[model samples]
Target chain A: MIARNDRLSGFRARLTGAGLVVLVSASALLSTPGSLEGAQAAQEAPDGMALYEAGCASCHGSDGRGAAADRIAFDDPLPDLTDCSFASREPDADWIIVSKAGGPVRGFSDVMPAFAEAFDDDQLQAIMDHIRTFCTDRAWPRGELNLPRPLFTEKAYPEDEWVWTASANAEGPGAIVNELLYEKRFGSRNQVEIALPFGFAEDSSTPASSDGGPASDWGVGLGDIEIGYKRALLHNLRTIFSFGTEVKLPTGDSERGIGSAEFQIEPFLALGQILPGDAFVHLQAGGGLLARGHRESHGTAEHDEDVREAFFHAVLGRTFTSGEFGRSWSPMVEVLASTHLADGAQPQWDLVPQMQVTLNTRQHVMLNVGVRVPLTDADVRSTQFLVYFLWDWFDGGLFDGW
Target chain B: MAGRWGRGPFLPCALGVVAVGIVAAGAAESGAVTGRIVVAEGQVRFAGEPPAGAEIDMSADAYCRDRHDETLMDRPVRVGADGGLADVLVRIVNAPAASASSPAPEAEALLDQEDCLYTPRAVAVRAGQPLVIRNSDATLHNVRVVPDSNPGFNLGQPIQGIQSTRSFETPEIGIQVRCDIHGWMTASIHVLEHEFFDVTGEDGAFTLPTLPPGDYEIEAWHPTLGTVSERVSVAAGETPSLTLEFSSG
Candidate 1:
C-alpha cells in the first residue's frame, strides 16, 4: 500500500508540471511580436473576402459548409452556413462577437480561437458580410424581426414553442392556477396550438343542503381545454398580421368553480408593428360567443339569452440588450378592455405591467412576470400575479442552452 | 526549434505578397463588353379593353382622382418606335468568382412613384447596394416589397417627397414592389451579385464594362416575355459587341 501511494503521488506531480509547461508555452506563443504585427497588418486590409479566405476558410470551408470531420481537429461539429434555416436567423452582431471574442464568450466551444487582436471591429463586420453570402435564400425572416414577446398580446409570427404559465390571486380568495401551452408551426404562416389548464381554488361560495346546513370546501380540478389555429395573412419587416380561432371545451367541474361550464368559441385578429428605436406595438381584437346557454351547478340551463363578449387588447414595449448580442430585457404595458355584446352591458378595463427576460445564452428560453390590476369594478374583480416560462423548441432542446 | 519559429513568421508574409501580386495582375487584365437589345417580332399592345365603369375608379381616394385628368390603365408592354424593348434586363449569367470581390458602386438605385404610377416600371440593382424609394404623389402610398429570396419590407408614405432606403443581403432575380393603397401600381427590381448587368435604355442599348477575358453566358430577361441566354467568348484587348433579340408570342 505504501509503494502504491508513492507512485500515485509522483504521477500527480508529473502531470501538474506538464500542465504548467503547456500553459506557459501557449502564453508565449500568443504574446509574440510577430503575431502582433500580423494582426495589425490584417486590420489594414479592407478586402473582407480575402481575409475570410485566409483565416476562416481553413476550418469553415471555402463554401462555408465546414471542414470535413476527418480534417477537423476538434470533436465539436461545425455550423453549416449554407443552411438558411439556421444561418438566416442569427444576427450579424452575434456572429461578429463569436469570431472576435471566441466561442466561449457565448457559451460555445473554446476550440474557436479569438481573433480580437487580428481583426478590428469594422473588419470583423466586413467578414460577417462575407459570411452572410453563404445563405442565398432570404425567404426566411431575419432574426432582427423576432421582437420580444408581450404578456397579454399574442405575437403574429408563427412559432414552435412550449410555455408554462402560473397565476395566483393577490387580493382575493387564495387560489393557484397553471396553464401548459404547446404550439407547433405547420406551413410558412400557420400554427396549431393546444392548451390545458388546471388549478386549485378556495370555494368562495356555499351551498345549502336539503337538511338546511351549509357545505363548502377547497377544490382542485381541471379548467377548460382550448384548441386553436392561427394563420398569418400578411407579413413584412415592419408589420405582421394574423387571424386565429380557438374553441374551448367544458372539461372542468362547474360546481367546484374551476371553470365556466359553457362551451365557447373565440376568433381574434392580431397585428404587430415595429416602431423606431427597438420599440413595438401589438394589438389584438376578438369576440367570444357561448356555444351553449349557461348551466347551473345541477346541470340545468339557467340563462335564456346567449352570452357574447368582445375584447380589445394592446401592448407597447421596447427591448434593451445587455450586450451587443447578449440577453435582452423588454418592459411592456398592456391595456385590456372588454364588454358584453348584450344590452345594458358596460365596458370593463384592466391594466398589466410586465417584464420579459431571456434566460439562456441562445435566447430561445425566456421568462415573463407581471401584475394584472383591474381598473374598474374593483370590488368584484381582484388583482392577480402572473408568470410564464417560454421555450422555443425549434431552436434547441430545453436543456441545451444555459 | 529556433529554425521552426523563424520560418513560421516568414511563411505568412510570403503568401500575402503573392496574393497581392495576383490580384493586381487580374485587375490590370480586365476588359469591357458592350451590347444592344431589340424586340424582334412583337408589337407593343395594351392589356384588356378599358373597364366599362369609371376607368381606374380613383374616386376611392379623392386626392388620386384630382391628380389625374383622365382614366388610367396599366401598360404592361412598351416597345419603342425602333423595335427596341424597354425594361429588359441584360446580364452575364456566369461571371468569374473573382469578379464578385469587386466593390459595389457607391451610388444608390432610385425607384420613384409619381401620380400614383411607378416610374421606369423595372429597375436592377446589385446586392449590397442601396435602393432609394421615393413617393412623389400627393396621397398616401404604401410601398410593399415581396421577394422570394430576400427580406421584405412595407412602408407607408403619406406625404410627398418621402424617401426610404433598403438593401438586400443576398442575390434574388426579381422582386415585386407594389402599392397597397393603389393596387394597380406595380414595379419590379432585379438584384444581382456582380456588376455585369444593365437595363436597356430607350434606344435598347446596354454596356457591361471592365470584364475579364473569359467565356461567359449572357442572358436577357423580360418581365412578360421569358428569358434568353447565349454563350460568348472574349480575348484579351478585344471589345466585343453583341445583339440580343426578343420576340413576343
Candidate 2:
C-alpha cells in the first residue's frame, strides 16, 4: 500500500512538468507575431544616397576623397574615387564584386569586410553608381578601352607604362636579347617612347684574314637605342588608330656582333579593333630605311649597299576572366612578315603564339610569354622565346592593391 | 533535461517563432495612381534646315546596301500628322513615399539591330531590369554603351540572331549606345529606379498606372528637344491628365 502511494506522487510531478511546458510555449507563440510584424516593417528598401552616406562615407568620405588619415582606423590608405585616371578605368562589375565579396575576392587585403548579408546586389550596384559620380571628367577614355597587349603587334591606345622584354634563341647560336621600353603620354592623344636594347651573342673572334670563321667567343654589349613618337589619329569605343615614327641609333660595338651599325628610321601605323566575346585584333605595318653607305659590321650584312625592309604584323586574341573582377588571361597569335626592299629579296614569315596575364588586383601589372617560330628560312633565322613584364604606372603604386 | 533543452533546441524554436511574426508584419500595402501624358502642339523646332530626306552613306558595306529597298535618310525627329511626338519619355521624378512598400516590377526592354540600323531609336527601362540587345543583320556589329552615371560596356555580336541581356544598376538620365562597325547606328536609353515611366506613342499620349496617391514631380524628356518638368498632386481614386511641351531654341 505504501509503494502505491509513492507512485501516485510521481505521476503528479510528471503532470506538473507537462503543464509548465505548455504554458511556456503558449506565451512564446502569443508574443512572436507582434515582433515579427515590427521587424518586417523596418525592412524597407534603403535609399541609395542615404545608404551611401551611412555605410561608405565613414571611410570613403562624403566627396569620395577618402577620410582624413588621422580619423581612419586601418593603416592602408583609401582610394580616391574622384580621380578619373584611376576610377574611370575599372568596370562597374568589378567594383560591385569587391564591395560585396570584400577585397580578398581580387587578391586584396582582408581588412575590407564582406557585406554579403548587409546589402543585396541591387543595393551594391546603387552604391557603385554613387561612387561613379565622384569622377566628373569624361574626356579620358574609359578603362574598357584598355585592351590586352599582344606579343608582337603594338596597340594603338596611348599609354603611360614601362615594359621589360627578353628574348632568347631557341636554337642555333647561343644568344640572349633584352629591351626596356618607357612610354609617357603627353597630351590626350600623343605619346613619346624610348627603348634601350642590349644583348649577348657568340662572337666570331677569327683573324681579319679569315673570310667566314666559326664563333669562338662570347661578347656582351648594347644593341640599339630607339626613340619614337606616336599620335592617336582616332579613338572611339570600338576602335583606336595611331601613327608613329621611330629612329634607331647605332650604339653597340659592331665588331662584337651585338649591333647592326646602321642608322635606321621606321614609320608605322597601328590599328586595334574590338571584336565580339572579348576578342580583339591588332594590325601594324611599317618600313625601315637605313642611311645610305653605312658600313656593315661583323660580315653580317647579306648585301653591300644600304638596305631597306618592310614589315607587317598582325595579332588576334581574346580575354578571359577568372571571375567578375579577378585575374584576366589573354591568349594571342601573332603573324609577322618582313622583306627587304632590294630586288630579288625573299619575304620571311614567323608566327608567335603567346599568352598575357594580369598579375595584380589593380590589373596594372602584367606578364606575357610567347615563342617565335620561323615559318620560312628556318635555317638562317633561329626560333626565339620571348617574355615581357609591363607595368601601368597610372593605376597605382607597385605595392598597392595586393 | 529541462535545463539542456532550454540551452539548445528551445532557443532556436523561440527565434523561429519570432521570425514567423516578422514575416507576417511585413505584408505589403500599396495604392495606385493613374494619369495620361499628352504633348502640346506645334512644339517641333530645329535650328537648321529640316532634315526631311537626308540619306546615309551605306557604301562601306555592300550587305547593308542590298538590304534596303530605298534610300534611308537621317530622321532625328519623327512626328505624326497630329503633331504628336512619338518617342517622348514621361516619368515621375520625385516618387511618393509609398514606393518603399511597393516591390519593383519585373520586365525586360529590347533593342534590336536590323538592316545595319538600330530600331526603336529610344527606350526607357527600369533600373535592375533586363535589357535584351539583338543583332538581326548579316554583318558584324558591336554594341557600345557610354553612360556618365553608370558602368559602360562594349559588346560584340558577330552572328545574326545573336542576343545579349544586360541590366543597369543605377538610374541614368540617358545612355547612348552605338555600333562601331556602322558609325551611323545609334540608340538612346533612359534608366529609372521606379516603374512610374512610359513612352508616348503615335498619339502623343502616355499613362502611368498603379501609382500611390501623393504629390509627384513629373518630367518629360526628348532626345533632342531637352526635358520639361512639372509638379502635380494626385488624390485617391482619381485619374489625372496632364500635357507637357518641348521646344528647340
Candidate 3:
C-alpha cells in the first residue's frame, strides 16, 4: 500500500484498519446472532476501527488474524478472521456486543476483553464493519442464519458436527435406543452424513429367572446404519432449504426384536426459518421405501413386498440467552406425522418438546433434552425420553473450546 | 463461474440456466462517448524512492499457487524504474462544478478475478456507471463490496468464468472490494460524481477528457498513500502536461 499518511482521512480504512481490533473470532460468525448484542445493535454505524488497535489487537493481532499462541496470555486457540466460510455470516451487532461486553457475553473465552470503556455503539459498529472486510467471500451462508437444531426435524444449514442421541421408553417395557450421527460439509452448499443406530430392550413377556447368570429375555444389538447426503438448495438471511436422501442397511438380527432387518431408502426436504424475537421454525418432509422383511409366526416364515411410508416433522422454537451474552437456551416443540403407504392406512402423530443449551465457552458443543409423546395410538406407542449431545467438530475439537 | 456475466449464485446445475438468462439480459452495457475536448495530460510519479516488493502468501490456496511459477507480491504502491506511479487515481475534481462538458468513459469498468487476484486492482468510475465484477478462477470466490455510501453486497461465484454487473449510485472514494475466500485478493472502486477521472496504468499517464478552458482543481489519489490536489490553468491554444507526484518514505 502507498505509504499513507496517518491523517485519519479514510472512512472504512480509518474505521477498519484504524485499530479497533474486535478479535471477534470465526465463532461469533459461525453461530446465529440473535442474542442481546445482535438484537440491540443500532442501525447507524460510526467509525470504530480506532479502538481495536488499543483494546483488542494485543491478542487478536492487528490484521484480525489471531495473535500467536505464545504472544497471547492465554493458551486458547484464537479465531481467524480470514476464514470466510465461518466468519462472513454474522451480523455487525454480534461482534459489537462481544467487543463491548467481553467474550463471556456470548459464551466465548474471557481473554477477549470488553471495549465498552473505549468506544460507543456507533464506533463498535464501525469496527464490526471493518472486521467483516477480513472475510471477502459472501457465498457461504452466515452463521446468524443458522437456527438451532431440532430433535427430529432436519435443519437446512450444512454443518460439520457429531451428535450422540439416546432415548428410553418413559412407560411400559424398558427399551433403550441410541444413535451416533456424523455430518461432514464438503463445499459451499453440500454435506454428507451417516448415522448408526443401536438399542437394548427387555421382554416383559418372560419373567426374570433367578437361577440364570444372565437374563435371556433381554436383547441388545446394533440396528440399521443410515448413510445420507444433503445439499442446500437456497438460503437468504432468514430462510434455508435443503434436499437429501438416506439409505439404511439391514444389519441387525430381526429375531432379537431390537432392530429392523429391512433395507429402506428415504428422501427428504428440510427448511429452517428465523422468525422475529429469536424464534425459529424447522420443517422436514420425507418418504421411506422399505424392502420386504421376513417374519416368523407359528414356526412359519412370511415375506411381504412393496412397503412404503411417508413422514413430516415440524419444529417451532425460540432461543433465549442468559443475560445478553451468556449460555444460549432454545426451547422448541416438534410435531411429527407418519403413515404407511397402504389402503386405509391411518396416520400417526407425535409431539416432541425439547430444550437445547450451549455447554461450553466456545458454544460448539451443546445438549438437547426432550420427550416424544405419541399423540395417536397412545395405548400401543409409548412416550420416550430423548437426549442428545451435539459437537460442532468444524469449530474445534471435542475438548478444545470448553 | 456459470453466472460468468454477474448476477449471483453458486447454485446447482439447474440454476445455471437461470443465471445465464440474467446475464444475457444484462449483457448490453451502454458505454460513455468521449469527445475531443482534451485539456491536460500528465504522468503520476513517486516523490521518493520506491519501496521493496512485499510477497503475498498464496500457499493458503493451492490453485492460486499452482497458477504461478514465482511468488506474488502485494504491489499497492507500484513505482516504475523511471519513477512513474502506477494505479493512481487522477481526475479534475472541479470540472463538473465549473459546468465543463465532461462525459463518463465510454467503456464500462470491469474488475476480473483471475489467477486468484483482482485484475486491475484499482479502478475509477463515475457515479451511476456500471462496474462489472467477474470471477475467472476455477475455485470458489465471493465478492464483497462494503461501500460507505452504497448498499453492500456479498455475492458467491463458485462456478468458473462467471461475472456480475453492479453499479454504485452515489459517488464515493476508496470503495473497498475484496474476495472473502482469498483474503489477499483486493480491489478499490473509486466512484466520482463527475466523469473526469482515470486510473494511471504502468506508465502512470492520464489525460483528462475535453474540458472548457478555465482554472480547474485537479486531484490525485493513491490507495495506500493519501490524497493530493493541485490547481491548473488551461488555455484554448495548448494541451498542458503536468506530473502528479505521490509521497513515499
Candidate 4:
C-alpha cells in the first residue's frame, strides 16, 4: 500500500507543478511589454499635474475623466482620474515617463506624440512645476527656471513701374503685326498683362491669325485673347498658367476669319536661379493641348472637329541688373520655341527672341519687343510686332517705401 | 634544520588564511540592509470636502502619479477625504548587487486604474516580472504613459468595466499615466529589480513583502513631496517596519 501510494503522490505532484508553470507562463505573456521593463520603472516614480495639462490636454482632454465619448465613438465609458482609492494606490513615476514619451504603453494611439524635441530640460521642468498643483496631500516647491520671448524682423516691399512694349513676329496670319500691351503689379509677387494685336495680311495666304482683322479670300486675320496667372511655388520657382479664347470678330468677309471661339489652356512651370553680381537665369518648359472645330460654309462642321496638335514650349532668359541708366533694374534677353504636332505628316515650329528692360522696385515695369519666325517651308508667310504698357495698382506708401 | 624550515612557512600561511576568512565574514555583515515602508500618518489627507466621485487621484497627479522627467498631472478621486484606500508607490533605486535579485526577479508590479485613480499610487517590481495595468472603472480610458530615460509607449483600453493588461520589458527610471478623456486623472509607475520596497496604504502603513536577506537602498517616492531613501538590512524570514517623514527637511 505504501509503495502504491508513493507512485500516485509523485504523479499528482508532477501534474500540479506543470499546471502552475502553465499559469505562470500565460500570466507573464499577458503582462510583459517585451524585454524593456521601462514601464515598471516608471510605475515606481511619479509626475506632476501642471506638466500633464500642458502636454497631454491638447489631445487627451483637460480632465482625467477622458475625451468626449460622443466625439470618437468610443466603445466603452472612460474612467475619472480623481478616485482616491485608485490614485493613492498608483506608483509614483510610471505616469511621468509615459507623459514625456507618449501613450504607447497602454495600447493607446500615438496622437499624443513625444515632446522630447520641443521641450528642453528647464522647460520640461516648468511644465512639471505646473503639475504639482494637483496634489492635495503633498506640497510642491517652485524651482528656478525662466523663459524669454523671441524677436521678429520686419520686411519692406519693393518699388514697381508701368512699362509699354511692342513686338513683331512672322508666324501668324499676316506679314506684320502690331500689339499694344499693359501690365500692372497688385502685390509683391503678383502681376497682370493684357495685349491687343492687329494683323494686316498682304497676300492673305498665311494659315494662323492674330487679334482683330478683316476677312480675305486667300488669307484672313484672326484674333486671340490671352489671360495669364503667375504664382510663386518656392523662393526661386514660379509657375504661369494661362487660358485664352480665339474669337474671329466680324470685319468684312466671314468665310476667311476664324469662325467660332476656340479654347486653349496652358500651364507653364519655371525656375529662376539668382547668380553672383545681381544676375539671374530662368528656364521654363510646358506642354499644351489645343482643340479647334473646323468650319466648312457658315454652318457647324462637327465632323471636322478633331484633337488638333500637341504643342511643346520652352523659354530661356538671362537678367542683368547693374548699369548707369537704371537702379534696381534688370534688362533681360528672352528666347522661346514651340513645335506643333497636329498634322502628323509634317510638324511646324516657331522660334521667338525678345529683349526686356525692367525698372523700379515696388512699381516694377517690364518693356518687351520680339519677333516670331516660322521654321517650316509650308508657304505660311506671316509676322507680328507688339508693344505693351503695365502699371502697379498697389504701389507707394509703406509697401514701396522700403 | 628540517623541522624549523617546515614550521616557518606553514605557521605564517595558516595565520594569513585565518585573517582573510575573518575579513570576508565582516564584509558580508556590512552589506545587509533591511527596513519597512508604511504610511507616516493614519491616512491620506484631504484639503477640501471629498467630492462624490467614484475614484480619486490622491497623489500629485492622483494615484500618487510617478514621473522622472515628464509632467505631473492628477485625477479627481471619487471618494472624498473619507475614502478608505490611498494608493502609494515605494521603490529601490541604485542598490548594491547583494540587495537586488539573482538573474531575474520573481515579483510583480500591478498598475490598476480604479475609480479614475491609480490604485497603489506607487509600486516596485523585479526586473523580469510582469507589470499589469488594468482599468476597473465603468468609464473608458486611453492610458497614456510618458516615460523617462526609456522608450515610451501608449495604449488605449476601450473596454468599459473590463481590465486591460500591459507589461514592460525594460527597467526604466520612472513613468506617468493619464486618461485622454479625463485630464484630471493621472498616475505614476517605476521599474526595478530589487527586493526592498513598499507602498503606503490609506492608513499610512506599508509592508515590504518577501524580501531576501540583504542590505538594500529603499526610497519612498511621492509625486508632490519628491523622494526619500534609507539604507536598511533584513534577515532571512524576518519582517521589519520603516517610518518615513516628509517634512521641510
Candidate 5:
C-alpha cells in the first residue's frame, strides 16, 4: 500500500506541472498580437535596424546616417532616409519593397544589393516593422515634384583637383607591372587624363602553353593624354564621349615587348549609381582606334609602317564596405572583357578580374590577379597582370552645370 | 435671381469628396489588430544524441525571452561522431534596430580549434559581418574561406595566441571556411542577413528576446539539420513557450 501511494503522488506532481505550463502559456499568448506578428516575421526582414547593423552599419552607420554625405560639397546632397518629415511621404510598403529589391530604378546605387535572396519574408517584415517606428510621415507636400539630381551640400562646378594613381602586381607566369594615371575634371563636362604603364614578365603562362620562356623580360614606355566629356542620359545613367590622341614610345629590348610608336583615339561610356551614402557601382564600355609605327632596329616584325586597328572593352564594377576585421574599409571587384576587331585577323579576346582595396572614398589601391587568354592564333597570346592605385580627386561632380 | 449662377454641378463634387474623406478617416482610426505567438525552441541532436557545449544566442531578446530561457539547452551533452547531436546556432534570424541610443543586443559564437580540428563543425552569422577565428592549439593555422560566388581570402596566423578576425562582405549560405595549417580543420559558415534565428543548445532550449509582440515566423537552422520554421503568436509583456521536434529518415 505504501509503494502504490508514492507512485500516485509522483503522477499527481507531473500533472500539476503540466497544468501550470498550460496556464502560463495561455496568458502570454493573449498579450500583444500585432507586435508579436511583426516580431515573428523579423527573421526575413532585410531593412530592419538589426539587419542593417549586421549588414550595412560598418559603413553607412548605425543610425541609418552616413558621414560621406556631408563631405560631398556639391549643390545637391545625398538623401537622408531618417529625416522623418521628408521621408514620411513615401509609403512603408514601398520602402520595404525598394529596400529588398534595391534602388537602381530610383537612381540609387546598384551597390545596395538586392536582399530578397539574403533575407526571408518574415525577416523583411521585421525590418519594415522597425522602419515604421521612425520616418512615419507618408504624405507628400502639395505642388512639389520629386527631382532626379546628384545630392550635394555645395556647388558641383569649379572642381580644381589633380589625382595621380599608381599600382603594380606579380604572379606565377604573369607580369610584374606598374601604371601611373592622372586626371583633372573641369566645369564643362570635359576631363583631362594622362596614363603611362610599364610591364615585365619572367615566365608568362597562357591557357594553352606548350613552350616555356623563362627569364623573359619585357618593358613598355607608354604616354597618353585624353580629353573626355560626360552627360546625363537619364536620372542615374550617363553617356560619355572621349576623343584623344595617345603617343606611345616603344622601349622593350626583348622579344616579349612591343617595339613600335603608336597613336590611338579612345571613346568610352560609363554609367554609375551612388547608393544612399558611399557605396556605388560603375559600368563602362568603350572602343578605340590604334595606329602603329614601325621601328625595325628594335626587333619590329608585325608593323613595317602604319597598321590601323579597332578595339572594344567593357567593365562592370562594384564598391562597398568591409568591416569584418577592424574599422571600416572599402573593397571592390571588377570584371573586364575586351575584343580587338581587325580585318583578316582572328578577333582578340581578353578577360581580366581585378580586386581593389580602398584607402578612402577618393583614393584606392588595386591588384589584378587573373590571367588573360588570347584566342587569336595570328596574334601573340600573352598573359597580363596589373596592380594600380586610383584616386578620384574631383569626385566627378564638376559636370553638374552641363 | 436668373443672373446669379447657382452652385449646381460643382456643389455635388465637393460634397462627394468630403464624404469620401470622412469615411476613409473613420476606417483608418477604427482598425485594430490582435494575435498571439508561441515561440517554439528547436532541438539540437547529434546522431540521435544531444549535443553538449553549445552556445545559443538570439538577436532580439525582449520579445521572445518570456517564452524562452537564457541558459543553453542540452548543456550536459556531447555530439557523437556517427551523426547524432551537434551543437546548433541559436540566433535571431531578423530583428529591427531599436534606436540611436537604445541599440539591438549583441551576440557571439566562440568556436575553438583544438586537436587540429574545428570544435564546432558549423556556425552562422549575419553577412557582411566579422567572424573571429582562433587556434586554441599550440600550432600555426591558415584560415581559408572557400566561397563559390564571392572572392575568398586566405590568411596565415602562424603563432599561438593569435586570432584572425575576417569579414565576409558577400551573402553566401552554406559556405565552407577551412584551415590550411591543419588539413582536418574544417568548418561551415551559414550567413543570414536577418536577426530572428536560433540554433539549439545541448538541452534543446532557446530563448528570443525583445519581440514587439505579434505573429512571427521562427526559423531554426542547423549545420546538418537543415531548417525548420513555424509561425508563433506572442502577446505583449508575456512569454509563450513551445516545442519543436525533428525526426530523421
Candidate 6:
C-alpha cells in the first residue's frame, strides 16, 4: 500500500501555452467513476495500469474490452481491445499519433477525442502499455508487416477483400478486359479466392451487311476463370512469406480471342518485405503448365500441346497519408516477365506504373489506376490503361463508414 | 484471535485455542510457524448487495460440461450471506522492506487444470517460488501465462497427467493465465515481493499474522472492484481486525 495525494500531475493542459485544449469534456469526467489519485512515486514514471485507469478506463473499460453502450454518451461502435488478432497488429506509434492529434487525424470517428491537453507523451505511453496487456497471446502477426497490394504481384498477407479490375488497350483494336475477384480469409493464415474475367474486343473479320453499314465488328465473351488458395508460411514484424497455387479453367469462348482454352495450373511463392522510410517491396515468381489431356483433345492445329511457360512479377512502392490520415496514397511500379519453354522463345516484358488511394474514411474501399507499357515485343503488344476498385470487405461495408 | 471491526458474537475463553489455529493457517504449506503474532487480520466485503457475474458457457468442451452436475455461475464478486467477499487480496504493503523481503520459499505452489478450469481462481505467491502446473483432464488442455514484468510461456497438454513448471523472478500483480482452446478457463496469479499477503476465501476474511510491531499500511485489491488501503498500528500479541468495504453507485 502506498500513500496517495492530490499532487499535480506532470501532464497538463498548459503544456501548449495556449490554455487548455479541452480534449476531455466536463461531462466525460462526470460519466467516468474513478478519481485520478496521485500515487507515492510521483517522482518516478507512473504505473501503466494506474494511468490507464485514470485516463482511459471510462470508455475503454478496465478489462480493455469496450465499455457497454449504455455507459457512454455516443453510439459509435468501439473496437474490442481484448481481441489479439486486431489489437496486437496496431503498432504503438500509430496509436500515439491518433491519441495526440485526435480521431480525425486517423480518419476515425470524432468521438475519440485528443488528449494533448491532459496527458504528456510519457503518460500516454504508460496507458498504451496497459492496453497491450489485454491481448495476451503473441502469435498474431503485426499489421506493419502487411504491405500494399500490387496489380500483378499479390502480397503475402491473407485478406478478405473484393477487387474489380478493368484494362483497355490504348493503341490496338478497341478492347477492354474486366475481372471480378473475391477473396475469403479463414483461421489466421489461410485465404481462398475466385476470379471471373469477361471482356469485349473488336473482331477484324466482320462481314458487311446487306443494305446497311458493316456489321458491328465487336465481340463480347467470358474469359478463363481462376480459383486459388494461399497460406502464409512465415511472418515477422518486418516481412511475410506465402505459398499459393491457382487453377485456371477453360471456360471462355476461345474462337472470339477471349481466352486460352487449354486448362492451366500455376503455383507461386510470394514475399513481402518492409524497407526503411515507409517503403515496401513485393516479389512473386510462378510457373504455368497446361493439362495435356485438354490441350491434345482439341483439334486445333494453330496451338502447340507440349508447351510450358514461366512468369515473374515484382513491385516496389511507398505509401503516404494525406495530412497525417485523411487519405492513404501509394505509388507503385511493377516489372512483369514471361517466357515459354519452347526453343527460341523470346521473353516478354512489361512495365506498369500505378497509384492506389483510399476513397473512404475507413480506408477499406480503394481505387488504383495505372498504365501498362510493353518493354519487350512492343511492336506486338499494345499499351493498356488499367484500373481496379478494391473493397476490404473484412472491415465493413463498401459504401458505409464514409 | 477473533478480533473484528464489525459486531459479531465472541467467546472470550476460546481466544487461546483460536490463536493456535490462526498460527497453523499462517504457516501455509507443510511447515511450522516462523514468527510470533504481531496480529493483523481483516475481512473484505461489499457494503451492500454484491454484483453478479455472467454465466460461463462451457459447451465447447464436453468433458468439462459433464463434470459439473449443474450450471456453473462465475462469481466475480463471490459474497457470502453476511456480505463477505472472496478472492480479495490483502497485504501489509508498508512493512519494513529490509526484514519483510525473504528469499523464494522452498514449498511449491500448485496450480492445477482440472475439469477444464483453473483450480484456485486467484492466488498470491512469493516471487522466484516454483509454480507447478498439472493437467488432470484426459483431453487436450494448455497452460498459458502472459506477464508484462516477466517472460511469458504457453504449454500444450494433449493427454492427462502432464506437468509443467515455471517461476517468475520479478513480482507482478494480476498476471493472467488462460487456455486458448477453452476461452472460459482463466486464473489470476499475484506475485508478491514479500511474504505478508493473503487471499480471502469464501468467508471474505484474511490473516497476515506475525507482522512486526510498528505503524504499517495495509491494502486490499480485487479484480473487478478497485482497491482500498488504510493505516494501522500493530503491537505484539494484540490482534488488529479491520473491515474494508467496497460499494458501487
lDDT per residue, candidate 3, A1-402, as tens digits? 000000000000011111112111211222554432342243213344544543455556668898765443346688888787667545555777777766655556554545554456766766676666566554566676678888777787888899998887777666777778899987777889888777777666575579865455767888667788888876656666677888777775555545556677778777777788989877776666667644332224546575566666678899998886668899999877666556666777678899999998667899999987877777766677889999988767888656
The TM-score leader among the candidates is 6
Q: Which tens-of-lDDT digit does each residue in A1-402 have in candidate 4?
A: 101111111000001122223322322322323211332233223343444554544344565555564433224444344432223222222234334454332223354434444344554555443333233322111110000000000001111233333333345433333333344434333445443433433444434445556544343454344444444322311111222222222222223332123444444443333334544444443333335543222123433454332222333344443442223333344333333333332433444455554334322233445544444432543333443344433233323322
* Per-model i-RMS: 22.8, 19.4, 14.7, 10.9, 15.9, 18.0
* Distance from true location, Cα of A122 in model 4, Å: 44
In model 5, the Cα lDDT at residue A255 comes to 38
Clashes of each: 0, 6, 23, 200, 84, 0
TM-score of each: 0.50, 0.49, 0.51, 0.34, 0.30, 0.52
Q: Which segments of candidate 4 are over 4 A away from where they belong?
A: A1-339, A342-402, B1-88, B92-108, B161-164, B209-216, B233-241
lDDT of 2 at A376: 73
Q: How much DockQ does model 6 earn?
A: 0.01
When only chain A is evaluated, what TM-score does every model earn?
0.76, 0.73, 0.77, 0.39, 0.41, 0.79
Score candidate 6 by lDDT: 0.63
Candidate 5 ranges beyond 4 A from true positions: A1-175, A199-259, A269-287, A290-300, A304-306, A317-320, A323-342, A360-380, A394-402, B1-249
Q: Candidate 1 at A134: error in angstroms?
A: 4.2
Query: Which has the better lDDT: candidate 1, or candidate 5?
Result: 1
Question: What CAPRI class is candidate 3?
Answer: incorrect
Taking every candidate in turn, the Cα RMSD to the unseen true structure, in Å, is 27.4, 32.3, 25.3, 31.2, 32.1, 23.8
Model 1: DockQ against the native?
Answer: 0.01
lDDT (Cα, 0-100) at A346 in candidate 4: 43
Alpha-carbon shift of residue B229 in model 6 (angstroms): 54
Candidate 1, chain A: TM-score?
Answer: 0.76
Taking the tens digit of each residue's C-alpha lDDT, what string does model 4 give over B133-218?
67675444566677765555555443334444445556754467766455555666766656555555444344444556667666
Sorted by TM-score, highest first, which candidate order results?
6, 3, 1, 2, 4, 5
Residues B89-132 of candidate 3: C-alpha lDDT, one tens digit per residue = 77777765743334554577898888887777788877777788
Give fnat for candidates 1, 2 and onward, in order: 0.00, 0.00, 0.00, 0.04, 0.00, 0.00
